[model samples]
Target: MATRDTHNLRSVLAVRGFRRLLGVRLSSQLADGLFQAALAGSVLFNPDRQTSAMAIAAGSALLVTPYSLIGPFVGVFLDRWSRRQLVVFTNLLRAALVLPAAALINGGGKGVAFVVVAFAIIGLNRFLLAGLSAAVPHVVEDRRLVTANSLSGTLGSICFSAGLGIAVLLINVLVSAGDSGYAVMALVAPIGYVASALLAWRSFRVDELGPDHVTAPKRAPMHSAIGDVVRGMGDGLAHLASKRGAAYTMAAKAGFRALFGVLTLAMLLLYRNYFVTDDDVHDSITGLAFVVVAGTLGVMVAALVTPPVTRRIGGWRWVAGLIAGIAIALPLTVSSFTQPLLVVAVFCVNIAAQGTKIVVDTSIQHECDDDYRGRVFAVNDTTYNLSYVLGLFAAALTLPADGHSPTAVFIVAAGFALIAGWYAVVAGRWARRVGDDIAQPDPVPTPVG
Candidate 1:
């Protein structure tokens, strides 16, 4: 029985449904994280750090194209299948896709194909991601969403960081002990996939959204194919255009992306006078922040707390203000480090700004319908890549040569960050025009059976 008495998150977490959801999340989150690390590590840990980072950035940037093309259709896929099943199968498929790369470690001519295979895996995996992201809220009661996001965020951070650190260990162990150690570790992909798939398959049972179960199935004639395609395209497009929530979310996302572009550059060695490759700077204490202790911890704090903060503030507007404050602080943060204590203060401000921004940004993105939200998210992802590239290129070219000492790079970028914050604030205001207004509920009612 649903408990009216379950008023708090603690109560909600204690319930069987959320516990089941958490189990399923735990099973899959680690693998999903490992997948990302493999991709980023392939690029980041290359013999040449900067060159590899730029190359990977460029190469992976292309993945966004398919996501844009396939996004609208993915939502349709979400509606048609069982959410639980999709979650499991996607992980399983990831395992399968990566296994070949792992198995043929020393095979002739295959070394070159590893990157290509990884790319393909990435593309196909989006289908799973699209479905799983759409299904999260469906699996939990509304009030417990903060807890869900918090737990998921923490899991994601640990999973990604650990995968990066451990993958190396696994690779080393395999190379020394087994001929196919490389290939063997590749099995991690599939192992995690299959395990998560099992969890998904067994943990939840739900209905697929087809007519046969509810009424009767009717076959469409082959002649109707063109009409069907046209109808699908139209529906997808209409769904996006009509969604005030999604639109506002994207607008806010765009601003965040823009500001994030500037802020990230600010954190670089070129922008920060403190050594660009400061081990202390990069490795924060937060196990969840991955490398940055403060950053990792800050992110976890935001993840666990942002939802309630949002609830208390009442809307995206307050969040926009916080982001704006961060943007304004970005350039100033560099100058704030005149002394040792100031350096610590500078870092804390950056962390707080980044953490709060991310928590708010992700929540808004996922707050809409499943189908078109995929397309919207794809667009958001695409924009994020482009923005990152643009900022990096600009930094490399235009940033001052004086190790973050001159205000030029920070100044220029900070201006943009402020603009982004203003843009987000505007979008928040307009979000009301759409439906993301904290003051208003979802504009369109979800479909009822």
Candidate 2:
């Protein structure tokens, strides 16, 4: 009964600024989905591209490493600048970048030029996302944050998947499976970003989505800006360290992401190489697409289930149990690598990962001071991306080319179990110290009129 009442997306969407914010989130993520799909189709699944586990791992690292490197510094600006302006500028920048990115892909450019341009686009995306997250709390009632997050995050993901599906369809229809099709998909991304930017600029007032304090830093010279970012990041880290719940939540989410990375690489290699015959590349791509769809369904289910489940179990225990559940289920399901078992495993893992993400997001919002929320979220992004890269690296070193390594799977499972146990213990002690404050409602921010 409680779950049914809490499941209403309409209630959250009814909030004034929240609807516009959701539009911005959905639009940006839709572009991200399309951009990523174009890259995947052109690079990973392209017939001309020779893919191996090592190559895939290298590509994954290149894509994510920039986020880890730039996230902290970007968080500084998210705190210091007007978030509304940042969103508008970043989206416009991404729109401009996509044009050249599409040209390069269309013109058969694939090595250094491709990586550098794509990296810049993705890095800018990270900044935009951090700003959006920090801005969300400003738009809604505090008591509804979990529901708002679940709706926004899950719906954003659905839009992303929808974007990917559309890209796939365009690829199939426009140019018949080659660089041209992928290029067409890339062209679609910029429109979403541009639209999102326009929405943000029109919907939000200057400094309305805030730094929590009225004072802005004096406009620094270009050289001083860099120094300020460095100092601000240091201060952000120190501030995060002071918050026990937020720190622990970040660590727990990072561990789950690392596990996710390992399984993602493993499954990529497995479907692309092992499950299908050498001449059946199309069939392999189809199989992987099915897995992606199943994973999307899992994400949707997690969105529906997480809010009420977290309320019943407490956020920390809920995350811990979800992780522990995955730790136990992974090895048992994936050891044989049957098609049905693999699908089930993918579904379950995605559910756990998405649920954990929602709880952590809300916990961070609740616990972290608004002044430092951007940095804390930035650090959270950095940790998850770095851990994922580490997982990919580990998989590259350990998994066979065919990706048929039960031992490697078991190792990841064991890691998850260990992290889950440690997080549970730590969260328990912290909860006692704070007197189970996770259950307490955050002080509601004044609703944006």
Candidate 3:
């Protein structure tokens, strides 16, 4: 009863900062969805199937790759400087970049410049996401972290799914009106970007404490740039290795992330085959049934249940079970294509996996110390993105454009999930051992008279 009450109180029904961030997340996602719609169907119009897909991906990667190069340096800066200023700077620049692309679309130019600018805007937006993720924890209290994150994740999923829906719907409307649909699609992102910028500029204070409290800035002596950078990176890596428990967390997260990447590739294939009909949604409303509704509910359960579950049931045992369930579900769904009983099983797996994933990720973040938090977190981000790219490329090669493509992706992703489940099992054991080492009782507190 007390536990239930505690969960209710920590319920995190509202926190102003989180609420603001949530709104921005939704708006940005709506725009992102529009962009996806803008790029999706036309890519295949070019000669080679693989080539066009790559072109579309490459355009987005143009943005992503640059951000990857800059993100670490940016993360370091985020820890070292005024976070608020950084937030405002990133938001304003992104908003400015986004507006012109939309204007170009409005003016009826789907030229190289329009695509190129859109790519750059998407890439830069990542740094803003990084900045926001890094800053959010600082603004919210420590205990409130899980609830805040859980809710945020739920909202993000909803917005992302809805954004895709909105993009499709808007494009349909534009076509009916005989307008260049790119303008309508492109406009969505800029509106969200501008809104996010305004929210940051007018509402939130650039939090100074996190930067102020972070580890001392490491300045290498003037020397050969390459050699110095390599050595500095080595030193930073050593600190990450020192945290035994943290190491387990990082390893598990990386494996899970890799699996996540594989799943993403599978999802694109799934939607292409199952949901789309001549670029129009068919009678099936699974996108609505699966993502917007079920996915959101899963997040809610994750947020509401994970804390107590982890504290009581412990970690690995719970996590391993979740992934294992996914492993079973994905293959069955792919092989049977959600045959009679299999479809229900797949949905159940999705709900369970999402819920536990929330707990596991949140706990990992909590374990991160302030000193190397940026580096560690950045590594997670980099690895996840790279994994996503590789998985996508591989799947695109194997998965066909037809409806059957989703099945192949699912089978491959199931393999990835099995690997993830294995990691969860091993990492859980490691976490327990680490716990034992740290469990040595604190030296008796000096007794007050």
Best by lDDT: 2
Of 1 and 2, the candidate ranking higher by TM-score: 2
User: What's each prediction's clash count?
Assistant: 9, 0, 1
Worst-scoring 10-residue span by lDDT in model 3: 44-53
lDDT of 1 by residue, 1-449 (tens): 01322344555576665566566655565665555544543333322233322443345455444454555555454554566666666676777777665554424213457656665667656565555545555555554555455566565555544555555555444432223433444557666667767877776665431111222224678768445544655675676566554455455555555445544544433322343334332222112132334454555665555555555554455455555555555455456533333344334444444444444335533454554444444444445545555555455455443235345535644654665566566555656565543332223768999
Please give each candidate's TM-score.
0.71, 0.94, 0.77
lDDT for model 2 comes to 0.83
lDDT agreement of model 3 with the native: 0.55
Model 2 lowest lDDT segment of ten = 1-10
Give the candidate order by descending lDDT: 2, 3, 1
Can you write out model 3's per-residue Cα lDDT over 14-62, one digit (the tens) per residue?
5666667767666776666666554443342211123233443454455
Candidate 3 lDDT score at position 221: 60
Model 3 ranges with Cα > 4 A deviation: 1-15, 21-27, 39-63, 103-116, 174-179, 214-236, 244-247, 257-263, 270-294, 338-357, 403-414, 436-449
**Per-residue CA lDDT of candidate 2, range 308-391, in tens?**
766666788888898999999998899999988999898899888888888888888888888899988899889988998888
lDDT of 1 at 329: 57
Evaluate model 3: give its TM-score.
0.77
